[model samples]
Target chain A: MPTDVRLPENDLLALALDFLLSHGLNAPQGHSLARMLVDAQRDGSFSHGLQRLPGTLNTMKHPRFNRHADPAPESVSPAVVRVDAQFGFSCLAAERGIDALIGKAGTIGIGLLAVNNGFHSTALWPLVERIAAAGLVGLSMNPTHAWVAPAGGTKGLLGTNPLAFAWPRKGKPPYVFDFATSAASRADIAMHRNAGREIPDGWGLNGQGECTTDPAEVLAGAMLPFGGHKGSAIATMIELMAGPLIGDRMSRQSQDFDHGADAAPCHGELLLAFSPDIIGGAGVGEGAERLFAGFSDQGARLPGDRRYRMREVSARDGIAVSSALLQKIRSQTA
Target chain B: MPTDVRLPENDLLALALDFLLSHGLNAPQGHSLARMLVDAQRDGSFSHGLQRLPGTLNTMKHPRFNRHADPAPESVSPAVVRVDAQFGFSCLAAERGIDALIGKAGTIGIGLLAVNNGFHSTALWPLVERIAAAGLVGLSMNPTHAWVAPAGGTKGLLGTNPLAFAWPRKGKPPYVFDFATSAASRADIAMHRNAGREIPDGWGLNGQGECTTDPAEVLAGAMLPFGGHKGSAIATMIELMAGPLIGDRMSRQSQDFDHGADAAPCHGELLLAFSPDIIGGAGVGEGAERLFAGFSDQGARLPGDRRYRMREVSARDGIAVSSALLQKIRSQTA
Candidate 1:
């Protein structure tokens, strides 16, 4: 019955890794995916957590999927590196490029890594957290298949198009957040749908290209860009930076590449690292402290603070997994 | 009695220059300020246009103002330049550093110019437009005096914290937009107040830390950050990037430096330029065309299209200045 099992952090990670390994993934590949899932679960991002495993496993051995693809870093320039992900998921690709990108930023004050032919249906916080931990500022942008409409138009011309930035502070958790340019992320909409709740106005448009508050219609149609035109512009910016700029397919092109396949949706990401020490002089630490002060003056929660707090709590008490998800995950592991 | 007066663009530029020169500014300094004002007016950005001159004139002759000071570009590294704006207007400083910044970006694939001790109560479009004209991507951010509160906090601790990004396309106006990280820009509130209208909810909070639709109360209280916590986080990001990271003052610190004086607000801006040909590969042109295709398919308006269209008409047909503004300008010129 599974009965809504609560598993220790290590056990969850082991289970995910074992499940992935049985599906033709190498140990390192399995480890990368497992770490991403466990980290998301521990951080209270349940949508990106274990619930995603079953869908991912179904695609892991897709006939057209490159199960053994290995991403290798190619230094396209002194400050830019391009990774050919060989049509694999980006978790392992990011793992392979993180050190190389950081090393380049250390020397040149900045570094850019482009991940082409990769898919990332995962939160970007992990890589950004690592970058910040290494005392560098990190910025990332990526595109999934298109689901968001442009500001004035009803047709979906862009992806939700997430962008992330992170800054590190000594003896404290890094300031980090990854946000979709859409008014609401897919997960938020999914939660509303599951609850049989109406979404807020401006959350999305119906398939008929009209505004609607029904979660189901929005899921079946298009998401609205957040902050109106400003949000749309950013999504376009992300499209350029992560798509053709990186010599990869844009969202629409990726859609064509996969022919609307949910399994192995081909997408791409752009990751950038900047060494605050070189670019910001010695004022980086002082600057971050002052910002912290402002946040405290108003009890403003820093971005990613909630996630860090949740991580600690989950690590201490374990993560609660839904019975349905646990049951499905167990079958895959078996 | 003066009526709404339309004046030729050159005439307006000359008039502004004359007014600044009369305030003891050198020819170059006067021209710098005048150019910014005329450009803003030409683009139909009335708030940043002629309406701002009187306050600027008062600041020009303040006892604490550094009249003869000029910012010079100091290349700190191959990819970064620092400009100490010398407690003067940033129009001239931006003018002085644009060439150096562009050249560096052309060489190194990217350039960062940090403007410290400068005032820029004008639209940032002209500079970004120039960068785009040179076939590069441009990004700018700055913090002025505090006017926006962090999300969930009653106290205002940040500026509107505007961010601008521009991307150039061949044979077309650049895709450019600038946005304040507040729920509503200061100008929007001012317009509502002028029109004797109440603002929408969530625009601002009264002094008592309660939401209010009254523009007067909002002006007396705090402006809400746009998009809730996400907006607050971005404002914080801008605060760090434009303030301590640039070796200058944060929004609150700038407010303190001004001591509530309007004269030379002592704010700063962060400018970055990236060459698409270098970082975005050789397919950038084709890529941009594809983006335009997407926009055309959906009939989405490009961000800077209207402004560019306005500029062209203003250049040919002159700008319509309000009667009050015209009267004030005529008085200064006389």
Candidate 2:
């Protein structure tokens, strides 16, 4: 609700894409990154939106970084595909490989895509939502450098691993939600830090491993897993799934390997897509109807409902980018 | 802990098996049920242990029950199999179908087994743990009758859905745990109810839709999801996955179909097994090592570490069942 620079949706996306092009990304890569950034801004995920542009641009500027490198994930098995992003962004890799995953699941019932040496810097809902839109159940896990301590432990040994899940709904927007196994994703914390706002209590631990509500302190310290030990365990599972399971950098290694700037962080992601026709088969519609009906009976809003509503408003009235952020993005291209 | 009657491991197994046989279960089912029950006791899951044996016995006696069913699941797609338990205990069916699931995951990169028309009474850890023991990543989700309320709402619109995950460790008991998406499972609530103990705060709601600590009130009302909206979304996903995706009962339908006095509540389960060699390929060992190393670095115990330690003790010293429960089993025999 601060003072803002409001532009039409097209102009916002065009400016964002043009900024990415200024950083030497190809049209396809620019479009991919811009699309995710715009959606995040539209849905009010400011940290993952325009606020992240400068850092991503600085990271991509490294001499060792190659935005155009297409690792071209290979079919490792009938239902497995592996992509070695080789210190590049996962944006294009995911865009390139999701179709293969969908096709494999269509044929074999389920498909898995392992992404290694990638830097994924967006809210992952869009990726899985795309898979859901393709009429398949989609689930994704992405691990970053460690910032979460194991439950009842002192060290930050786990990633604030984020997971996304989506399934198709009959004649409606697909049901979807993305969450970090940790109390909050780093991006959410960063947003709080930028806003100079206090985060909710119990959201994180301080450097001394004591609970604190200061977003700045949390950024310097660690995150608490959402549901105590259970959340920590899931974070562990996701860390492995995105890390060594894909022959990629583990959270610990990624923390050590972080260059601070001019390079995407070394990390990984895992995605699974399951076809309704193959897995749900004859009962697909019935299952969807039952799920929606129950959700309605409780007057419980479905997960994707928020994003769907936000998308419509953003498309119509456009998104509000702060004047400060707009000036910063423009300065980046200067 | 309640006073118990210590019995030798062999004697306990023998008595439990005999008690199951008295209810007319075949030798295979008696062995399976007894094995799971004994393991539950061994692992200190008393709620899922011998405490609920009488209810199971009575349920199996229902005229609508079919204990001798051999629901040999049919292979739907290469990576998918569907088992209709044909209105019987899932013990024998799971025991019979597990090998096939492991084999399929070994052949393909991933395998999915859907079990419908089944009453799964035991803790699901044992099933997924078996898959992990076979050197695969195992994930299982089962949905039961309604007991959980959606986040932001107070109706029991969802099941106390349980999810289990396991991954193998080199030269170690597999790392695994199973958890209800609800704050606590229905069985856990029932245990507290029987003990006349107050449930923990945030565990459930009263009939008037207000939070309460009374287990009786929760039983009459609803259980809250473990991690607010996130857990509720996952539970919703599990409910649909185990129901329509598997051609079985959704939470509402199952609640209505449940024969109050006889037969285990009709429900369904979904299982996925992913072979490390097939999915992770050459990185399998690295993945396990990285995961275990993280736990060790933090002096953190893996999820199932307690179960493994207890199993050793139980195997050596045997489990202790309550004298009253023993008398009840004996009474059944008489």
Candidate 3:
């Protein structure tokens, strides 16, 4: 059995920043990456937390990875902000563009920010949550490496292609959800492989296009989108809007760029922000509360409730990680 | 077996327009509804075609139904257009707002149109296709009557909540897809009921929350969202964005307004337009073609191919419907 090791939030953040800085990421990039990893840990989103440190390190070793690249954002129009990530991580790029995105939404009632040429590995909820914090509604989506098949096709042609949404609330956390279009996330499949466990049915097909439960086979094969064709359509939508719509690499191109190196996929992201004050008017908060109450009145949980709950607990008692993983992360800093 | 009756596209449009005008709809409203129904028939989307005329007639009989309301579109901000449907059908409202929405996107790269207090029963494809025709990407979504359950909950609280997306293409029809978040559309369920057939599993649950193939039971109970929890989340997002964000009715509220009379649900519709010229620069159409080719190369049909193919055949051969239904519609005009 793996022992659990608990660490204060600040300690984990410091370790993450140190690891990134030692690995050649600049100050702003390190802070952005470190903050994202720590927040994910704090929210119990372990799939994107400290456990991803080694993957980040591996991606850094790629020759094309520009460790010192600083993203530059340009206002292309009244409601459009375009950011060139310059081959760096997406965290800082998103960070730099957010205020402008929010400001445009504030003034024009809606705004769009498209981040191009960024390696995006973190969960999207954080970015949308920030928009919600500003009392605006946010929608974001991006395509990653192609590892999923289009519906009715046998080959990998779509990415997991996660879609995320956020709505601001009054005196509480915002309503938010971020999820992959795939039946199962790559992280989930990788976890199953690491544990030598069989994946559930409907997750993926073998390379031969036959359904299989073997994680390794699925890794080499193609995952199916959730909800069949509808999910596939959405994944394709994400691919278009985040890829060619922003003049960034499509999922297949992102994977080809890796050349089987297993590094983080480099691509673009699209975020749209809307101001409730301007769009929904004065009753916005009250109206949203009614919907939220409907969920809690029943036993049904809102999408981010569990994560928010975990975040509170972590804030109080710190984040607990498997001792072995904790040691691995600690050694990365050295 | 029901005898098939084939009618020219112009004949069907004329019949529909006459039926609506006779039912007390104003000229513009009649034209809007007639065009929508005919277009749906032309595209082989029978669910929203002339088959819905009887339902429209039934809805018109409701006391609160407004037959002469003219929608008024207001520019709320540089990127937001709000149209008050004045308790009339949404089609004309959408028609009135599209030019403004397109203009805003052309100037600002992104635009949003929110139609409030409208009865939206038409398929969303026609609307998004119009935006695509203007050389822009379009997205539209709206909540219908409450008939869907949250993923883990048994009761209906969410709408079927159709979401539509369209991207312009060169020398071909735009890539478009519109689908309900529910496991199966209410139209499909109603078709099953009318045919005295059992629906497929996963479509819905009985009042007790147990899955059932009986379409009647599901109708009396709740429909399931497509893709389990992820679909449920998307449904919820649609509810928030289309409902509270637009200051319109939620699905439950829409159903409540019908007072169990089953009239078309009066609510709001949200449409967003994005300009590729400003956002993606010069390579969008060509880049999208590459993605489209990838789909064709793998023998994967694009999302809107079926509808577009049907549209061409309908253009050449006209539309086919059952003789019995055609007689019913003809008698309604009388």
For B218-258, candidate 2 gives per-residue lDDT tens digits of: 98998999888888888888887777776778887876776
Q: Kindly report the docking quality category of candidate 3.
A: high
Each prediction's interface RMSD? 1.9, 1.8, 0.9
Provide the overall lDDT of each model, using Cα atoms, as 2-decimal numbers: 0.80, 0.79, 0.89
Chain B only, TM-score of each candidate: 0.95, 0.93, 0.97
Best by TM-score: 3
- Worst 10 contiguous positions by lDDT, candidate 3 chain A: A1-10
Q: Which stretches of candidate 2 lie over 4 Å from their true place?
A: A1-5, A62-64, A190-198, A262-264, B1-3, B191-197
lDDT of 1 by residue, B1-334 (tens): 2226778988889888877777787776788888888888888888778888887876765556666767799887776787877877887887788888899878867777887778665878888888888888888888877878888888778888888888888887788888888888887998899889999999999998789999989988999888777677778888877776666778887777776566645777888887777776778778767876888787888888778888888878788678788678779863
lDDT of 1 by residue, A71-153 (tens): 78877666777787776778888878888889887786777888877766588888888888898888888887778888988
C-alpha TM-scores of all predictions: 0.95, 0.95, 0.98
TM-score of 1: 0.95
> In order, how many clashes per candidate?
1, 1, 0
Q: How well is candidate 2 docked (DockQ)?
A: 0.62
lDDT of 2 at A36: 86
Complex DockQ per candidate: 0.55, 0.62, 0.82
Give the TM-score ranking, best first: 3, 1, 2
